[model samples]
Target: AGDIKAGRAKATQCAACHGIDGMSKLPEAPNLAGQTEEYLVKALNDFRTGERKNEMMTMMAKTLTDADVANLAAYYHSLGKQ
Candidate 1:
């Protein structure tokens, strides 16, 4: 389990596409709110590892540490019901 408070703090950079509330403002970005933590973690990991490739996401995901991925997944999942 991740710390929600820490996750919230770490999510500022994600707010550009995925809203602060975990809703995506851009059509290309998926809404992250209410998504399963496992899904979010896997998606981010895929982006990080090149298993899934979106140009922007791949770049962004590459910079994230393992803890960052976990925290991000936690924050997004906390936004609403799954």
Candidate 2:
């Protein structure tokens, strides 16, 4: 839970594309809130690892630590049922 809160703090950067609640502002950006943690983690990891390739996401995820990925996954997962 604390990690999720921390993720919220980190999420301000995400808010430029994904809304505060994880809704997307850009048509290309997918909604993230309410997504499963497993899926979110996988997506982020893929972005980080370059398996799933998007220039912006790859760039973003590359800089994020594994803990950051998990925290973000947990936070967005917490938004499930929103």
Among all candidates shown, the one with the greatest lDDT: 1
Residue 56, candidate 2: Cα error in Å is 0.7
Candidate 1: residue pairs that collide: none
- Per residue, candidate 2 scores C-alpha lDDT tens digits across 20-79 of 899999999999988988899899999988889998898888888888888888887788
Candidate with the greatest TM-score versus the true structure: 1
Model 2 alpha-carbon drift over 4 Å, by segment: none
- For model 1, residues 8-46, the per-residue Cα lDDT tens digits are 888898899999899889999999997999999999999
- Residue 5 alpha-carbon offset, candidate 2, angstroms: 0.5
Name the runs in model 1 displaced over 4 angstroms: none
> Cα-based RMSD of the predictions, in order?
1.4, 1.6
Model 2: how large is the Cα RMSD against the reference? 1.6
What is the Cα-based TM-score of model 2? 0.92
Query: How does model 1 fare in lDDT?
Result: 0.90
- Tell me the deviation in Å of residue 10 in model 1: 1.4
